[model samples]
Target chain A: MISRTFRRRVWLVLCALALGLAPFPVSAQQSVYIPITGAKKLRLALPDFKIGSADPAANSLAQTFDGVLWNDLYQSGLVEMVSKSFYPLQQPGTPTDLGGGALAAWSAAPTTAQRLVFGNVVVGNGALQVEGYLYDLTQPNKPFVLGKRYTDQPTPAAARVIAHEFADAIIAALGGGPGIAESKIVFISDRTGHKEVWMMDYDGANQQQLTHLDAICYSPRLSPDGSKVAFMELSSAGSRIRVLDLLTHRYARFPRLGGTNATPAWSPDGSKLAFSSSRTGDMEIYTINANGTGLRRLTYSPGVDIAPVWNPKTGAQIAFESDRTGLPQIYVMDADGTNQQRLTMSGYAVSPSWSPNGEALAFSWRRTGGGEGNGGAYDIYIWYLANRNYLQLTHNGERNDFPSWAPDGRHLVFAVGENESWQLFTILADGTSPAKLTTAGSNTMPNWSWH
Target chain B: MSHSRLRYLCTVMGAFAVMIALAGCRHKPAPAPPTPPPAPAPAPTITLNADPTSIQAGQSSTLTWSSQNATKVELNGASVDLNGSQSVSPTESTDYEAVAYGANGQTASASAHVTVTQPPPPPAPAPAPQPSIQDLWNQNIKDAYFDFDKSNIRPDAQEALQADAEFLKQHPDVDFIIEGHCDERGSAEYNMGLGDRRANAVKDYLVQLGVDGSRIRTISYGKEKPFCTEHTEACWQKNRVGHLVLATPAQ
Candidate 1:
């Protein structure tokens, strides 16, 4: 039990401490990826976007935009959302409304929001207008962190896109690398009675079938620029590598190297592809120009040398899976196939996906005896090239495989199998917050876009 | 014989009296030696016969044998009665032999030459229709299984490929496709690559065995269509194989 004056003094001291430690200068031009785990999560208020039009669809579209923006910011792991219950009866919808006592109300008392994201949506004559802003509330004079305008057709799709843009701006302003809001994930799904390639948003929305070949298709690797996707297709022509032009939505001509070609992976520059082909009576890694000419074999070993993934930072190095030592293990080599070195020493490791920074590799590994079907379970592991340290990203008994790194380098999307049903799941690189991305039919072999 | 003998007898009578006197002085001469017995018969004779004379694999044949004037009889180096019969099943063609020992230390042997031919396949049930090339292939060619994430032609796979090569060579006009499959493990893309390796391993082995390479084609169905659907090791093993199929015109 304390006196009212003593309690008031303690509260003042705590407020002073919070004000001293909370605010950091977040410039809009900084491009470095500040690790979310290291950066203090800022408290941000994301009030509902104000609807500025009488159009019947504007109400729902604004709601959709506001919801999507909030989710994106929350999922970025860079901010802690201030509950709506803490908001005052009147919330600012634009920079002009941040005048008077609005900033003081948001920065004080129960709201205590150090940052605020406010926007307004308008629909008129067939076009949608969105003006979004981010303000640093804790700073003197409440400086603007981000302010942008987006215009598109007044549709739900456009609303979601506009909201994603605003969230990306806020993320980039906070010292995170280019946000992954607009990124897409391509994977294989069997929902249509036949396995085919499918594409979905980074958050598992807008799932659309990309291929209707009605034959088994797998390993859809989107190009770095998101213009084309290279996949492995099995049909009457035998197993071959095919590319789908995402820009034109047509099948691009990829030369058929006879006798079983598979697992086409795009180089960082998207000018070439590396894949495994048996044309020489052995499965070896080969690279060909995007137009399918200038074919060159990069491996000549006797055993299988397959699943080649180019390092995203620099295309000079390639990592792949090889069973040359009698068991599948991850290996790295120069682009010319020289200086071949084994990265994994024991157990079965395959499906090597290089991290976006090229400093590490993520692969599916069964590290115990007896291989698959034995007691050992396949788990995702990240092998750091510089430190030679490995971090196990999953410990679940379910089969977690094909770990494709997200563009942010802080997350991975992999196929998780349980009870014979496979689904896609995204997990943080630090091995937290495993969120399932797909549920309809079995989905597998997910490849995250490189953008 | 009449005159000469009478004269010799008169002369001998005077000598005989002297000889008798000399014999009486010899004091009980040794008893006359007994006459020697006739020589024994020659070495023992043996006859061995296989009842059916020949048998296929998994079939049995009876070996009957008899020996005359022999102290001991043995069949195929194993001792047996002088006259006996036994059932023998030999996986390969063999010779059934019998050896006999005579009383006077002489040996004689005879071999029946069982000629264990592969038993004519269970008299092909009922109608006994002639088997087609497809049937022959289905009976002889076997799928080569792979270990988890392996593509090397195993020792057992080599044997299977040898038999497949023989069948392919016998039917030169028939072209075939090797469908490589994988278990429900690993990435589909990598498994595709693994399946490709497996199919290529089979084709390369067949080519090494003198099968024409141009007549062979390969495809990999990386865990897409599994031969066994269960999640057990045995089932996974069944799914991981290089299965040979008769190629259709479109393929």
Candidate 2:
């Protein structure tokens, strides 16, 4: 039989050991959070201007002013204007003279009225000056006034310029980015007989011609810095790679490799080049230092290996097309001659261009068994590097080839054959509705400039 | 009467002695208990003299051992095939060991390593000079000229072809593959077809000259296999010709 005192001593010892072995609670460190402050939303009101000149010959001026103002505001996508004809043309009583403040007088017009804009136009000596004031209905004392003075301009045209200037100031005062309504897109158009690189505003205005070479030139690749263009030109001898200095109007040839040379691809670093050469008894992929020395061959198969493109993010690997399997297929190999592997298993594929993000490869593939004329009708496809899944971006039976991805990688520009003439078209990466960007001649092989 | 009284006294004395004997008993000493045996002595420990030692290249060595009362014996190291002594090949050598164990759980071990060097490979064969008909013809035709508007063999050409034919006849199984070529002045397609005719003409002449026609075959590589790089008539004349490839039956 055990004693009670002995049992109590054992229990006390057990409690002490349990308490000594217990784990301590941990405390987390404190962190600071910063909140982002957004700019205040300001509503701008436009002033109403009456047609001071009603001369029959001056009607064009009135129409031009109204047109410019309406188009500018509509394109802004920011301002909402109250209908002028919906309200009666009567002046309300002065706020100080009445028992109400400016806010009460502004709100007295209508419950839906948020702001008010008043303006007047005066024409003199074939010139015009317009002044406008924007008043906030909620805060009567806070009103923004803007004025524009135009000289050496006709009464009709001056009003148009004043309206545009007013819209520009309002956009800037509201702390918004500049409107791109006046920007342009520089592209190549063959509308004037031969394919000549052209530049126009993004809205299709101010078109200008750049290249005048009479020979056949294609595959215009823009430099990453956007100051030069590297393209392929066919002369009496054969195809030669040339670079055009956009600023100097001078051109230099990428050193020739004995046989026909085409498809000049600039490395991501812009310090080297990867191109195809047949000088080694067959068409194989070759890379040369940008200064043209150290020409090393990267592929050694008895097949037509062409269209070498480098991964934009990593200069250590290159993707190209090889016919070693008796048909054109996509292949990838190290920047050096190691670890050569095929990436695609079907169809005659060509013209592989890497996306700027290096996450996908955009190439053109012909439908199987589609021979000869069917060769022209290729579908633009993208291969996801992570999953090896491919998505076709074009559904039209017409030819779609030479896909060049935009700098953002969200859209792609390619040449589409329509009505027997090739035109430039842009489509979303998901193969949604495509928009025709050019309406003229046979324009093919568009390379977007990396800006 | 005196004698009877003495017998009675003796009887009484004897009877008293017998009574005293019946009351007293004699006892023997007990045998000493058996003594227990002493505890057994512990087993003797074993010791070895030779240990596994490394040897340099081209060296040979032996393993030696010593043990105490060992009944079971073995040699364990890099190999058991050494069998007390090992002679390593000159190309490769290795370490060895000797081990012994007794039934009383005592064990001993010994080892030694040996090494050897390797030899080099043999030399390559010499190249042979196998000249073709074109080489022989070019050597003998240093100044020989062909007739105008004709591809017939001249005197020099005949001498060269005869030597080649004689060489072929001596080796019955040997065959020759001939390639005919033309100058670059004529149309490529026409010259290709014409070169074939010139080679056949030569082959037919060889057959009539006692050479087997079955041993010869011809191909035309027209305008492609030019002998001279210049554009002059002299270069063109030399380029318009035939080439021959000779081979043995086993080649």
Best by DockQ: 1
Off by over 4 Å in 1: A1-39, B1-130, B152-159
Full-model lDDT for every candidate? 0.83, 0.57
TM-score of chain A of 1: 0.87
fnat, candidate 1? 0.54
TM-score of each: 0.73, 0.42
Fraction of the true interface contacts (Cα pairs closer than 8 Å across chains) found in each model:
0.54, 0.00
Q: Give the runs in model 2 whose Cα sits over 4 Å from its true position.
A: A1-189, A199-207, A371-377, B1-251
Taking the tens digit of each residue's C-alpha lDDT, what string does model 1 give over B19-116?
A: 98998978976889999999787779999988787777778889889899999998989899999999988888888889999988899998987666
Whose lDDT is greatest here? 1
